[model samples]
Target: MSGRAAAEKSGAMTGANEFKLTQGPEDSVSAVKFSPSSAQFLLVSSWDCTVRLFDVSANSMRMKYQHLAPVLDCAFYDPAHAWSGGLDNQLKTHDLNTDQDTIVGTHDAPIRCVEYCPEVNVMVTGSWDMSVRLWDPRTPCNAGTFTQPEKVYTLSVAVYTLAVFQLSVSVFQLSVSVFQLSGCVSAECLVRLALVMLTRCVCFQGYVLSSIEGRVAVEYLDPSLEVQKKKYAFKCHRLKENGIEQVFPVNAISFHSVHNTFATGGSDGFVNIWDPFNKKRLCQFHRYPTSIASLAFSTDGSLLAIASSYMQEQGDVSHPADAVFIRQVTDAETKPK
Candidate 1:
């Protein structure tokens, strides 16, 4: 970890507050997200090829949309207009007001992740085909396409950069005119570390990457080498036994919008709140029974959604069902100890 981060994390610690159990999909939930306009509204994408809309305030499913294949990831461009990507490799927009669906673009392989950059009026999708393509919803046409050496497993959008990464553990930065990739985090080391960074989100100037290796890297997007030197990673979600680290993969990461503090969920079934500035966990969240596949904070950061699913780590799921958890967040959760 960087000295800057170490200096910041020295004085903070938090406890994971419990989660409010909510009914979810009959199948393993792939992602859990809150609406950009309001925290009361949430969405859950499942391997069952369905997306369920829930009224969190009411604790009821509001509407359900089914696709041709399992839905992998989704994002809202706005309250009424949103997009969903699935195993079908198709990106489609769903109109919440009318409940209508429309195709936006296509990927050669399953669309593992999608992100909306409201400032640029563009949508980005990462795929198994090893490409990241930009789409302009206004024209229903692709703005541009960029290829990577490995399968693109996740995508995230910041003010000036688009992050595309693969499970092999590399991140790429894409812009409208210039695209650059910082030094790759060695895949072998990542594998040895065993953190599966399948889910990631843009925080501010940097992106938070979680790994199955039991570490989460705080990476800088800047192309300059000196600034890049400031980037560092920390080990979390692990245990000490015989002085050997029994690390659990950090399966999910979500950044709070207002505070910039992020939350991490892991195979250990625990979710923790962190202040990247301090580079320390501010609080720990209630643990679950299964691995956390995804995490999302509402636009206002008033609510947090956690999804527990079959991560393929346990072979066959004994219960064969997924769960959803939403917790109302308070400022105290992120307060430095």
Candidate 2:
């Protein structure tokens, strides 16, 4: 990190400290992702039915993209060109450069997650309709689809030094290319008619899936039996009450851009950073007053944007209001705690 950038990252806050963004979404903001190419830029998706672009340094919303319904998740193909999926059951690409929005795909039910793997050169979208589809940016038509055995809620994708990754594949190829990770679960809305899986994230060589059951499942890509052999699962985001274990749904996960590390947030009202390489927690944040709906690490690994918001059954008053926090993360903080 450059001196100026590092100063902006940490400034005078040596101990646990975070800077609040200016004006934030009026409604619960469920997702906060830093731009892939720059740490100063970020995108926020919210129940307010809008996706706003912001300059992290300025803390100002520079642009707003509206959808017919609440946006569940989003991914940037580039700084200007990105994809968003929402309750409208539509996946649309919003081009910041031209300010043009194009609807490229539709789902039988609402789309739950959207991800882009640059190395593999593909975009994946998962929906409640029990399907995940892959698309080639070169064309609007879906290049492939993965029909899950159960209703799908969330997913993620990663790339490695494989010869190539293709969506259309034989049984053998699918055994290698198919990755079924977890998704995001919002804690703000009522859970009466909804089953939630809100977010997932692509880790180093594979992906991490977080569930309402308070578990994080780590699995890798194919082609290497050893990598797959290292796959494992663990319990997290849980609390004990009256000698009984009460589990909270995992709401979001964000990988450190440079640290080979990742963070998981849940309704337990905490964000835990982990070094999966060592199978240990680097740090745990306990300042949030409510469930953590979303998390994203900046491109340089110097900053993390956290959205602590309400996402539960309606009329719940345990927590109210929504806000975003930008914290400076350093090597010292990543030390085992």
Candidate 3:
């Protein structure tokens, strides 16, 4: 395997030198994510049509499930059950302990991505059918579905790119914060932002907040009905194409837990960071030989874990598979003006 050495500067370290784990059942891997608890556990989705959980510290497999179609994406609902979606047009949940799984429901088209709310039992899925569906795994029924314009598969294709935050939850009601990208024609079009409110009765209230295509918006959800009355939004910047312009679609997006930062990667073979608070590009790193499949930030936002597929022509003619890179993000020094 040919590996590039990232500079040893304060903010740069060899992401390829971090902890590595190999997951085998043979299909191409689509997505891999770390739990909110940091390095404790990780969830992975594969084209082999299954979701596998790995013990990061021990580099061992804890559990696995067969979703029946190429499991395109997976996300943890907590640390226990994971929500997985794929070409089967089905949304399913897998229990990490029992190694059991059930099909919650089906979508009109293949489900491309799934995400769980940080502070609640709700989950949302994006699909090629041009709709985002919300579900309460606790109920195993449809909670809500947000429909977008026709020919808007970009939103669904980018669904794995979705992010969620809790707004509020009470004995009677629950509120969630979510955003999606629209109007992406190719690489030049800016992604438009659509923010929506989801309630327990399966009601959806959506509104457009911005028309920038590649940018990501984030918000904190209030748990109380009263606090849910306030409006807030943050934007994430995309990397500028200064070198070769490749048409790799961005597959995933992640935000730092405590910092006003976020990261995005795509088939373009680069991972870029941004300050969500100020909407400024922080820095960019490129060393992956293939498309970036997924990204995760450590609990303290100190380490970044990246999963990528290996590209051919770069060497390693045998045993071609996916690789993971871990990067350390350092704070910049302040200089007096």
Candidate achieving the largest lDDT = 1
The TM-score, computed over Cα atoms with residue i paired to residue i, of candidate 2 is: 0.77
lDDT of each: 0.71, 0.69, 0.56
lDDT for each residue of candidate 3 in 128-165, tens digit (9 for 90 to 100): 67566778777777877666442122221223234322
lDDT of 2 by residue, 222-306 (tens): 4478777887888888888999998887888888767667888888889999878778787887657678889988988888888
Candidate 1 positional error at 14, Å: 20
TM-score for each of the candidates: 0.81, 0.77, 0.63
Task: Please report how far candidate 2 places residue 77 from its true position, in Å.
Answer: 1.0
Clashing pairs in 3: 166-221, 167-221, 167-222, 168-222, 168-223, 169-223, 190-213, 191-212, 191-213, 191-214
Best by TM-score: 1
Candidate 1, residue 99: lDDT = 88
Q: Which window of 10 residues has the lowest lDDT sum in candidate 3?
A: 199-208
Off by over 4 Å in 3: 1-17, 118-120, 151-249, 276-281, 310-320, 328-337
lDDT of residue 218 for candidate 3: 38
Point out where model 1 deviates above 4 Å.
1-23, 167-205, 223-229, 240-245
lDDT of 3 at 23: 50
